[model samples]
Target: MKSNDKLAIHELLNKAAYGYDSRNVDMLVDCFAEGAVMSMSITDGDLIGPFEGQNEIMKLMTGAMEGQMDTRLHNISNIFFEKEADEAATVLSSLTLTAVENGSIRLLTTGIYRDEVVKVGGSWKISKRHLDLELPF
Candidate 1:
């Protein structure tokens, strides 16, 4: 992979992570394609989604961000990728969510993110993302 391609991918990942940490819905939305999907596994052994479309994705995230005293710091690391072309790729990374409740912060969950990313109109956007979590159970 070219250095520039790697940089672009890293930038895209950081943008999403930071957006989530900041609770900026619009910024988080901008990191994805119009038809992106986000899924994560919960403790009850239920899987969140292939969230299917942009609206569904928004709903899932918005619901998580609303009426919650939890403050989450979504930190991402160890990103790896397989580039299919200049326009398509798959990425994987590790994530840690620092959760705060009642003014105390603790490591809430650890997970891995699998992403399908594409370059559309000269910008990289995540077309799909699924978080397979560990340690929340």
Candidate 2:
């Protein structure tokens, strides 16, 4: 893959994390393609969802955002590319989630994000994402 594509993909992943942390709905929506899918697993428990399509995924995201009263920090790191092409890539990254409420900050969880992204109109957008959490947040 080209270096620019790799950079763009990295930015895309960071943008998603930032969007969620900042509660920027529009930014989060832009990160996903129309048919995007998302799922999660916590501590080897049952799968949460294979939330199909952008609308369903947004419902899940917005719900989570509304439920949280604290400030969230979703730190994305250790990004690696498992596969790449001109228009698509599979990426794996680590998440260290923290929340701040009042004067206290707490570590919520750590997780892994596996994402399939495609270039849509010259921008990378997540087509599929699966998250595995070490603990429930």
Candidate 3:
């Protein structure tokens, strides 16, 4: 893959993580394509969703921003590009989540994400993302 392509993908990942942690729905939504699908499964909180399209994703994110939790932060690292092409790429990233639940601060989750990102409108956007949790909150 080209250097710029790699860097662009990294930037996309960074923006997604930072935006989610910051609770900026617009920023977070901008990282996805119109028909994107994000399926989330977490052992804690009994949450499993196969959110389809940007609207559904935004709805899910809005809940996260307004949830009863005191605070939540999502950090991404150890990104690896499994496949890269002019139109699409498959990437895997390690995830670390910290949050305050029931008024006590705690490590929420540790996991990885399998993402399908595509170049749409000349920018990289997530077409699909599936998060796998290693531990619960």
Q: Give the winner by lDDT: 1 or 3.
A: 3
What stretches of model 3 exceed 4 Å from their correct place? 43-47, 100-105
Per-residue lDDT for 19-125 in model 3, tens only? 88878788899999999998867653455778999999888878767764567777889999998888899999998888866778778779889999999988999
Off by over 4 Å in 2: none
Residue-pair clash count for candidate 3? 0
Better of 1 and 2 by lDDT: 2
Which regions of candidate 1 are displaced past 4 Å?
none
User: What TM-score would each prediction reach against the true structure?
Assistant: 0.88, 0.98, 0.86
lDDT of 2 by residue, 13-131 (tens): 99999998888989999999999999999999999999999999999999999999999999999999999889999999999999999999999999999999999999999999999
What lDDT tens digits, residue by residue, belong to model 1 across residues 26-46?
Answer: 988889999888888865468
Pairs of residues at least 3 apart in sequence or in different chains that clash in candidate 3:
none
lDDT of 2: 0.96
Worst 10 residues of 1 by lDDT: 41-50
